[model samples]
Target chain A: MPVITQRLRVTARLTELARVRQFVHGCALREGLPERETFACELAADEAFVNIVVHAYGGESDGPVFVRCRGVANGLLISFVDEGMAWDPTPPSAPPWESTETEITVGGLGRLIIHRAMDGVRFTRRGNRNILSMCKFRPGFSPAE
Target chain B: MEVKITEYKRVAVVQPVGRVDSNTSAEFEAELRRLVESGRTNLVLDLSKIDFLSSAGLRVIVSTMKSTRKNGGNVCVAAANARAAEVMKLAGLDSVIDMHPSREAAVASF
Candidate 1:
């Protein structure tokens, strides 16, 4: 099967979250990922994109953000590159999902879920840029149908 | 996501339709809190209309579920499609909350 790869440029705004999701899902579909895997792809994309909008830009404002998806020999690789102030999401930490009501606050839970849903997630500080990547294997076929 | 609240007797069932993402979760947050503040603790979310759910939406549901439980009430989800159901299961919410195949079953769980 031919590998599928694509890139999407989006404004660093929360509204573009859907656009990002569409792009990722489109890539996954071409890669023959299942519906469940497609959902996982969308969820991972949502969390990473939201982190960019909310934290990378400090919710203040930022320039264009680039989301690139490339199908490799084994799976899909999604990279999010932003020009916002550099921050690494490598050291993941968040309150437990089963924590008490007070600890179950809505804050920082997005990243946690992303970590759980994706096979591999990494954050890098390239100069003054923040680059986040998430990878998941192509489970059989069609990530989004 | 689009949220519509329907009143069943004294209970309020919040239905969030479409994919719940960062852009759409605020609407859910507002509507869910509104139902709770209005003393509609006996709540059920009709996920039948929801085709997809993101972590942001899950966060809202989990938080509300915790709050509802603390208030001596409950929040259940009904008729979640495959996409929504998979995420709920991955998040382990399927175990904590009552998930039904239909709204009637979810409402009856209260």
Candidate 2:
């Protein structure tokens, strides 16, 4: 199948997450990805976009977050680009699972979701732009090992 | 997100509809906190209608759970859709929060 690509640019704000998610879902549907895989891709993209909007700009400047989705080879590739702060993209460790003795706090769940939902993830920095790329392979279409 | 609060077997059941992402999680959190402050300690969040659940939503759940636990109560989850369940499992929330296949089971767990 021919690859289809779609791109969107929005301000680095939390309110823009819904728009981004819609774009991803549209592309996923167009690509004929299964419902479960589409949801996984959407979740991974949401995590990456949220991270960029909340942590990248650092409350100093408002910038645009660019998103690109490509459907190719029975998979989806979603990339997020932002011209905010430059930081490493290492996935954070998940918080302790047992909530018996301590109060559950909020942290590290985004990275965990991103890493777990997407089959492949990569981060790159180039010329003041931070790029996060995630890929989800369709079920029953895995490449030969 | 639209939140509906009802009582089930003495447990406060909070059901949120629509997406619970960064854009809408604050509202969801506020409702949960209000319920906690109203002395409704036990919570069972019905996620069947929620189409999306992001980290922001997870943060609200964790905070609410903590507040309720401090009051000698707890929060449980019920009827999470596939996407919500996947995100919760990825975050290892299944271990931290009690999740039930249905509202009855969640209310019973509490």
Candidate 3:
């Protein structure tokens, strides 16, 4: 089937997380994605949206987060666009599971989860906008393999 | 999100109902940390009631799992409805954390 895409605009607030998840899930369902893939897509979308809501707009006020859900020829494509701070989430580092005895506190692990869940992830800065596109390939339903 | 804590056999079970999103994510993290700092490391999070989960929530789970694991204890998940379980699974956390079908099952695993 050809690619089908859906678009939405969400505010930079945490409350919108549910709405965003719901929107993505709805689109995935309409695109005939399997139950497992649908859930994964929702979560991956949630992570991307949360990053925009929390880090974008300097964490001060609300802004716009543009979301797109599409069924690509190979898999699914979800794009999150925002005019917030540009940050690259892809890094060659694993999550810190190191044993720390002297009490330790660390954050910034959400990006790691996002990077590992989706099949493809990219960050692009165009003018004043930050666009993040993520792709998830259907398991055991590969046309290329 | 609504967070409810229940104690069963010396373990504190946190049941966070509803969606764990941006606005309520911090509150969930705070509650989990409070329990961990107070030495209530034997935690079983009942996610069956949670309809939705975001990365913010996943981060809290990962961090808590690390903290409790380091302290010779661990946080488990009891009864995550399909959706919540899928979120945990997608993040590759299903292998990292202990997940069971019921609170009793989770406690038994510990």
Candidate 4:
């Protein structure tokens, strides 16, 4: 079967987060992705979009966030490209689940979540645009040797 | 976000319909913070109506919980869907707060 793909583009406004969630969730469910994994994609994608708006663009509402979700070999790829400042979001480690005021308030918590909620996260800067991609693999599937 | 607060003698159950993401988290936080400041600190968050949740929403909860705890109060979760539950669990929130199967259970815990 050919891999199916869905894409959406929206301004870097907080109001646009809902559209990103629906767009990503709809694509996952339509492709028969499991419920657990479906939610993961929805969240990971949302986190990335928020990161772009809050971090990449400094809370600016007009910056455009280019989103593209496509089915790949044994997994789904949710990618975002934007013309915002370059900052790779790959987290070194997930914050301790301690829920302390210092831990959550110091920042990088969202990055930890985006990493833990998805199977893979990759980042690259292409000239002026930043490309951040996250992957969620199908159950009982593993990359071939 | 539309947040409904059902007040009881011991606890206030806050139900928010729709998504609690970056856009709406501020509103959600405001409602809960209002309750906390009003001395209604023990809170039961009925999340059944919540369609989606993110770190922004979780941040509000954590901060609110901290505030309530400072006043010898606490917060519990009610009817959180699997998605909401999973995210909370991922954050190790289950260790810090209680998550009940229903609003009744959540309120009863207080």
> Each prediction's Cα lDDT score?
0.79, 0.83, 0.78, 0.84
For residue B90, model 2's alpha carbon misses the true position, in angstroms, by: 1.8
**TM-score-best of 1 and 3:** 1
Per-residue lDDT over A1-145 for candidate 1, one digit per residue giving the tens place of the 0 to 100 score: 6665698999888878878889999998877677767668888888788778777887836577899998886678899999887654643354456677543543366676777788888888888788888888766545554
lDDT rank order: 4, 2, 1, 3
Q: In candidate 1, what are the lDDT values of residues B14-66, reduced to their tens digit?
A: 88888787778788888998888877788888887887787778888877887
- Which consecutive 10 residues in model 4 chain A have the weakest lDDT in total? A98-107
- Model 3 off-target regions past 4 Å? A1-4, A99-108, B33-39, B66-73
Q: List the residue pairs that clash in candidate 2.
A: none
Report how far off residue B99 is in candidate 2 (Å).
1.4
Over B5-110, each residue of candidate 4 has an lDDT whose tens digit, in order, gives 9999999999999889888888999999899989998999998988888888888888888889889999999999887888887766777778899999999999
- Scored by TM against the true chain B, the candidates give 0.94, 0.96, 0.94, 0.96
What docking grade does candidate 4 earn? medium
True contacts kept of 2: 0.71
Say which docking band candidate 1 falls in.
medium
Error of 3 at B73 (Å): 4.3
Per-residue error for A11 in candidate 2, Å, reads 1.6
